[model samples]
Target: MHNDCIFAIQLYFMQPVTGFSKLSKSQKIDWLVTNHLNDNATARETLTQYWNEDQKLQDLHDGFSENTVTNYYFPFGLAPNFKIDGQLVTIPMAIEESSVVAAASKAAKFWMDRGGFKTVIKGTKKVGQVHLMYHGLSSEMDAFYAFAKAELLQSLEQINASMKKRGGGIVSLDLIDKTKNLKGYYQLHATFETKDAMGANFINTTLEQLATTFRLKASQFDGFSSDVPEVIMSILSNYVPECVVNVSVSCKIDEIGTINGVTGKEFARKFVQAVDIATVEPYRAVTHNKGIMNGIDAVVIATGNDFRAVEAGVHAYAARDGQYRSLTKARVENDTFIFEADFPLALGTVGGLTSLHPLSKLALQILENPSAEHLMKVTAVAGLAQNFAALHSLVTTGIQAGHMKMHLVNMLEQIGATDVEKDLLRKEYADKTPSFSALRESLLVLRS
Candidate 1:
C-alpha cells in the first residue's frame, strides 16, 4: 500500500494539471505564474497587460480560442491609393512586420500614377473529397459510383438550397479511381461554388451528409454484396487551383522613367531577371512567395478570413506544376513593362469572425462590403503590389536600406529609448543603415 501511494505521488508530480482551461481568466493566470513561469512578477504583467480596455471586447477575444488568458495584439494599419478596377481603395493590413504596410503603400502610390492594378476573376470553384475504402472489383466500384452520383446530389438538395439560390452550388462530381495505388482507395471528388462565403462549414456539412447517405445506401446496391465501401473521411481541400484570380500592373518603359538613378529600361530588365530567378529556383521562390503572402495574409487577417487556409491553398498552387515557382511574372512587351501574378484564394466577406469580431466588421465596412470575388481581387492586388515593392528594392536600393531603416523604430522601442532619444536617433539614421548593437550603444551614449 505504501509502495502504491508512492507510485501515485510520482505520477502526480509527473503529470500536468488537469482543469487548467476550466479555471477563470484570473485564476488561470494565477496557476500559470505559480506552476509554469519562473519570473512571477514579469510574466504576470506581460501576460495580462495587453488585455482589452473594454470588458465586452476582452470577453469576445477570450472566446476566440481556448484557454482565456490575454489577447496578443497585431498592428492594424492601412495602405492607401490602390486603384483597382478603376476604383480607389485603401487596404487594411494587420501585421507586426514594420515595413510591410509602408512597402505596400509605396508600391500602390507608384502604380496609382501608372494604370493601377487590373484584376480578372478566372474562376471561383472550391474542391472537396469524400475518401472511401472499397475492396470490391474496380468495375463493380465504378458501377456503384455511377448509381450513387445522382443520389448523392439529390440527398444534399436541402443543404444546398440557399447556396444554390445565391447563384452558387455544386459544380461537378467525379469518381476518382485510386485502387492500384492504395489497394482499395477511391474518392467522390466534388467541386463547389460558395459565392460570397468561404463556405468551409457549408462544404464540410454537405460532404458529411453525403458521406452518411453514401454509407447507408451501400446495402441497397448489389455491386457490393459483402464488400461494403467504408467512408474514411470527408473534408474540404485547400488546394484550390481553380479558384484563381489574375492581377497585373503595367506602364510604358519610358513613362516608368527613372527610379533611384536606374533608368526605366534597365530597371525593367533587371526586374524581369529577378522574377526569372524565383521562377526557376525553389529556394528563391519560397522567399519570393512569402513576401507576396506578407501582404496577402495581412489583409486576409485584418478582414477576419482564415489566413491559414489562404496560405495552404496559395502554397499548394505555387508547387502545383511539379516544382515550386514564383506567383508573380514580369516582362517587357511593346515598350510596356508588365508585372502580373496569379493567386488562388478562397476568402469570404461574411460568416465566421467577419460578423463576430468588431474589427473584422469594420474591415469589411472599409471595403464597402465587397463580394467574395471583389475581395479576391483586392487581396491579390495587395500581394502583387507587395511583391513589386520587394523586387523593386532588390533591383535598386537593396532591401535592407529601407527594411533596416524601418526596423530602427523597433530597435528604439526595444532599447526603451525616450521620445527625445528616438527623435535624435531617427534623424541620425535617416540616410544610414542602423544596426541593433549600434542602436544600443547610441542610446547608452545619449543617456550618458
Candidate 2:
C-alpha cells in the first residue's frame, strides 16, 4: 500500500473522528489530541491546565466568542489614594508592563496631600462622517445639502428615539465642502451626544441611514435631478476633538519639597524645562505621551473601555496645533508649581464589554459605579498623575533607577531563580544596576 494509505489506516485504528465542530467539548478535545498531537496525554494535560475550575464560568468565557480557547490574563492592580475632584477614588489597572501601576500609585500618593488631582469634562460630542463624491457644480451640492439636511435628521427619528429618551442622540449635521482640497469630494459631518455609551454602533447606524436618505432625497431634488451624489462610505471617527477632559495638579513651590534628592525649587524649574523641551521636540514628546498613556490605558482597559480609540484621539489632539507637543504642561508662577493636561477622551460606562466581562463589571463596582462623565475625569487624572510621576523621576534620580529596581524582580524570575536566589540577588542589586544577562551569569556562577 502507499505510505499515505498505510498512515491513514493506522490513524483510523488509533482514533476515528468526523464532524469536528459538531462534537461535544470533551469529544473535541479528545479528537484534537488523538489526531493532531504526537503526545496526546501531554497535549490534553496542557490544554486543561489553564481552564477555570468552575465549569460554568469557563463555559461563559468560551461563549464570549466563537471557537473555544483558554483565557489570557494580565495583572489587575489597584492604585489607591487618588483624590479626584474631592472624591477619594481607587483606580483599578490591568496591564502586564512592570512598574506602571507602581509609578501611578506613587504619584497619586505624592499629590494626595498636595491638593490631589482636579478634573473637568470640557465637552462630550462624538463625530461621524458620510463621505461623498459629487462631480456636479458646488452650488448644486450646496442646494442638495440644504434640501436634504432636514430630511436626513427627520429620517433618524425612529432610530434615535430610544437614545433620545436617555438624553443622547443626533445633535447636529453639517455639509462640509472639500472641493478645495480634493476634486469632487465632500462630507456630511454629523455630531452626537452618546451619553453613557461609546456609541460606535449608534453613530454608524445613524450615518448609514443618513447616507441612504441623502442619496434617495437627492434623486428627487431638482438640483441633483441629473447628477446624484455618490456615497463612498459611512463610519464613525475615532478622533473626537470635541470630547475632552482637563486634569491638573498644583501646589506651592515650597510644598513640592524634595524629590529624589532634588530640592523643591530646583525640581520645579527642571520640571518646567523638561515639559518645555517636550513641547518643542517631537522625539521627547513621543515618549512623554507614551508614559502618560501607560496610566490612561491601564484604567481604560480595567473599565472595559476602548484604549486604542482613546490613544488615537489623544495623540491627534496633541498634534492639533501643527506640531506634536507635550500632553502635560508644567509652569512656575509666583513660587507656585502647576502641572496640567488637557486631551480628548471619549469613554463609556454602560455599553460594550462593561456589562459582559465579569472583571470589568467588578472594576466598575470598585470604582463606585461612576457615570461616563465621572469616568472620564478619573481616567484623565490617572494620565496626569502618571506623567507627574515619570517627570519627577526623569528630573531627579533619573528614570532608570526606579525603573530598574522594579524590573529586578522580573529579571530574577526570567533567569529561573529560586526563592533563596531571588532574595540574595535582590540584596546584591540593591544599589547596583540590574541587568538580565548579568543576573543570569551571576546565578550560573552561584549555582556552580
User: Which of the numbered candidates is closest to the native, going by highest lDDT?
Assistant: 1
Cα lDDT of model 1 by residue, 153-269, tens digit: 899999999999999988898889998789889998999999999999999999999899898777788877457999999999998999999999999999898999999999999
RMSD values, in order shown: 4.0, 4.5
lDDT of 2 by residue, 194-229 (tens): 999989999999999998998899878886644688
What's model 2's lDDT at 225?
Answer: 40
- Total colliding residue pairs, candidate 2: 0
The number of the candidate with the highest TM-score is 1
Cα displacement (Å) at residue 82, model 1: 0.5
Off by over 4 Å in 1: 1-14
* Candidate 2: residue 434 Cα off by (Å): 1.1
Per-residue lDDT for 94 in model 1?
Answer: 94
Ten contiguous residues minimizing lDDT sum, candidate 2: 31-40
lDDT of 2: 0.89
